[model samples]
Target: MRISLSTLGCPDWDLDTICTTAADNGFDGVDFRGYREEIDVTQHPQFTDRLVETMARLADAGLTVSGLSTSIRICFADKREENLAEARRYIPLAHELGVDTIRVFGVGDAEEHSLEELARVGGETVRDILALDGAADLRWLVETHDNWTSSADCRLLLDELPDDNTGILWDVGHTTRLGGESPAETLDAIGDRIEYVHVKDAVYAPDDENAKDDGWVFVLPGEGELPIDDALRELDDRGYDGWVVHEHEKRWQPYVADPEVAYPAFAEWYRTVLE
Candidate 1:
């Protein structure tokens, strides 16, 4: 198993600082969500013109790339061109960075379409993206988020895609916190398709002013009500050897703990809990 840091945790950190902090915090890779305020990082200079230099710096920091998270929505018919374009942009960059997996999300009007129907269209969108030049070899993973948090529900999309290269990027936080599914239950449903994971902790803090819209507040891993230990044990028992990414959403919630505090703490927790 490997541990990595999501740049979403340190939204304001420059690429150089991201590398240094990840290396110092015992992370094996840094998952690039974006840099500074740029959500579409392919448009950012570090990934565009300075790619070679960027790769050298990441190598100097002794890091591997976990993956890239994209805001591509596969189920939205309105965003089909946008989805394919994002894939087109990312494929070459992914080839350069040696990243094999890219994260994506799915969306649909539930009132108008069944989950299976949404997944069908979403699968076609993914297939179209994969048909783009340099995309066949890369894996596109739909995250367990929003409407797709339930493993069974997510499997509708996973089942719709080609089995060889598509799968789920399981976000444990959402499955437990919002989807109301236990770690064991989630694994039982889609464990085989789980090639990547997002690890975070949260508690029902409905009364807290700082709580998220869902009445839950994010917390350091192993410190909240989430089943971090159970999740790890379940994965280990199943011979799962995927990246465990600490997805601290500092970009979305500016008030959260800084990556400097959260990253190392996750590393420490990962060590102690596993031991």
Candidate 2:
């Protein structure tokens, strides 16, 4: 499995710094979640107007643009047009950058809508986005997050979009810690549809100031209780050869360890354990 790092970890790093750090640290690819203070790559000048230069820079650094991580939530009722527009905007950019996958989410809240409703909305949105031009060349991945963390719940959305171009971004941390599903069970349910993987580690710490509502605090890989090894073993057993992205979410949870420290640690651990 190839290892990649998400820009979500280095919100403070500019494009040059990002590519240099990724290359120097032995990352095979760089997943763009954000750059500097901008959260949307589509709106970022480096991607929109200066794409050729950006691609050249990455090539010079010996890194590939693994994927573009977008905040397009398909399961929300009020964001249908917004989400579709976001997908339409990114498809061509992804094609230009030679990226085959773009990460999206099914961010449904159970209190706001039933699982069935979320599935219906998310399915329709994804279908519409997939129908757009240039979308067929790229994979649109729905991550295991929010109400769709459970493999069973994720299956509802996956069943609706049977297109081969649409697949799951299996976030092992969410499935194990949040959805209460083992790596084996999650793989059993949606392993065939997984096109990408987001690897992170955390422990239940309600008392910690940085703890999310689930009482989980992000930690460097191999430093917490996420079943990362088991998940990687399962992926290996299945002959999965996709990118294993280290999703250090320092963009959202600022109190976590700096990316400068956490990113290299993950690279070393990943090589030691999986390479």
Candidate 3:
């Protein structure tokens, strides 16, 4: 399997720094969750007007564009047109960047709507996006996040779409920590639909008031309670050779180690444990 780091880890780094640092750290690719201060890469000049140069820079660094993670949430009831527009805007950008997958979210409050409602709406939204021109060459990945962290819940969304162009971005951290699923159980449910993976580790820290409502505190891989090793082994057993993206999430959670520290740590740990 190949390894990549998401720009979410290095939200302060420019394109040049991102490429060079990724190359120096032994990462095979860079997934663009954000660039510098801009979370939406589609609107960033380096990716819009200066795309060719950006591509050349990555190639020179012996790195590829793994994928683009967008803020588009398909399951939201109030943002149907906005969600579709975001997908339309990013799908072509993904194709232009020669990246195969665009990450989206199935985010909604379960109290507001049932899982069935979210899955149905999210599935139809992704299907509409896939039907757009030039979307055939791209894959839309719904991340295992928010209300869809459980593989069983994700399977509900996948069952509605039933298209090869749509798949899951298996976020091992969420599935194991939040959804209370074992690696084998998650793979058994949604293995066939997993086209990409996001890896992070964290521990339930009830003492830290800043911890998430569920008391989860982000930690470097192998230091936390997440069963990432088991998940990676399962992927290997299934003959899955897709991108395993280290999502440091420094952009959203600034308390975590900087990408400078976290990126190499992940590269080394990943190699030590999985390579």
List per-candidate RMSD values in Å. 1.0, 1.3, 1.3
lDDT (C-alpha, whole model) for all candidates: 0.89, 0.89, 0.88
For residues 82-179, write the lDDT of model 1, one tens digit per residue.
Answer: 89889989999999999999999987777898988898888899888988998888988989987798887888788789887788999988898888
RMSD of 1: 1.0
Candidate 1 regions exceeding 4 Å error are none
Model 3 whole-model lDDT (C-alpha atoms): 0.88
For candidate 1, the per-residue lDDT at 161 reads: 90
Model 3: residue 176 alpha-carbon error in angstroms: 0.7
**Candidate 2 residue-wise lDDT, 8-71, digit = tens:** 9999888888888898889999999988778888888888889889999999999998999999
* Pairwise TM-score winner, candidates 1 and 2: 1
Error of 3 at 12 (Å): 0.6
Model 3 backbone overlap count: 0
Identify the candidate with maximal TM-score. Answer: 1
Question: Sorted by lDDT, highest first, which candidate order results?
Answer: 1, 2, 3
Pairs with backbone N, CA or C atoms under 3 Å apart (clashes), candidate 1 = none
Q: TM-scores of all models?
A: 0.98, 0.96, 0.96
